[model samples]
Target: MTIAAYTLAAVLNVFILFIGVRFLLQPFAAAAGYGVPATQDRAYLEIKGVRDTTFGVVGLVLLIFAGAQAEAWYMLAVALAPIGDTFIVLRHGGSKAVAFGVHLATAAVVLISSALLFLA
Candidate 1:
């Protein structure tokens, strides 16, 4: 359980970091994958990239320096991003499948990670 908890948290953090980088480097593609299309203004896409990057770094820092409980709390709080994303996609004329399948599923996984971290 301990190993699984830590591994999951680490993997999630790294994966999010990768996503952040993808958003920064390939905003259009990233946005498409995120269940939304990029508009003319790239500002928001860049902001999302930075936000996700910061979150990934923070999660990794919490797990490494602050321990499982802190990581658990962080995970619990960060889950809100995906929850909000679900709505964002839905409201933006994105497909329901992507909205729920991607964003909601991510929220569920993040929540599960939080629960596992708490148990750890």
Candidate 2:
């Protein structure tokens, strides 16, 4: 359980870091994969990239320096991003499948990681 908890948290953090880099380097494609197409304005996309990148680094820092309890709390709080994203996708006329399957599912997984970290 301990190993699983740490591993999941680490993997999620790294994956989000990768996603953030993708958003920074390929905003259009990243937005498309995020269940929303990008417009000509790149500001919002860049903001999202920075936000996600910060979150990923924060999560990793919490896990490494602050330990599982801190990481758990961080995970619990960060889950809101995906929950908001679920609505963002839905409201933006993105596919319902992507809205629920991607965003909502991510929220669920993050919540589960929080629970596991708490237990650990």
Candidate 3:
């Protein structure tokens, strides 16, 4: 059993749960962090909230239900998603801070998770 892998999986799962809660409870703030302002349309806000929450929950489930190695692979695959998100935010007039702070940060964390998984 690799210590780093287990540690990474556990930490990542907890963080994902936190992210899911943030999306659900503070949708606007979460959206702002995601480099997007809340839209006037409720549907769009709901979409973001639901999507983020789902991702978080699914990530957590991968760790809990699957295993550290599996979660690691999941993290690796999902890294591309945030990379894409960074560009999307930038292309859509999002500020640098939001793009880097949220999306880039997420990608880094995911990469770290992947490394840990690999070490495991």
Best prediction by TM-score: 2
Q: Give the poorly placed runs of model 1, Cα more than 4 Å off.
A: none
Query: Model 3 lDDT vs. the true structure?
Result: 0.76
Q: Which stretches in model 3 have alpha-carbon errors above 4 Å?
A: none
Q: Model 2: per-residue lDDT, tens digit, 28-119?
A: 99999999897777888988999999999999999999999999999999999999999999999999999999999999999999999999
Which prediction has the highest lDDT against the true structure? 2
Error of 3 at 81 (Å): 2.4
What TM-score would candidate 2 get against the native?
0.98
Tens digits of lDDT, candidate 3, 1-118: 5776777667765665676577667777777777877755655656656665676677778777887777788888878878998998999899988789888888998898788777
Better of 1 and 3 by TM-score: 1
List the global CA lDDT of all models: 0.93, 0.94, 0.76
* CA error at residue 49 for candidate 1, angstroms: 0.3
Question: What is candidate 1's lDDT per residue for 64-85, written digit by digit as tens?
Answer: 9999999999999999999999
Return the lDDT, model 3, position 68: 72
In the order shown, the candidates' Cα RMSDs to the true structure are 0.7, 0.6, 2.2
Report how far off residue 80 is in candidate 1 (Å). Answer: 0.2
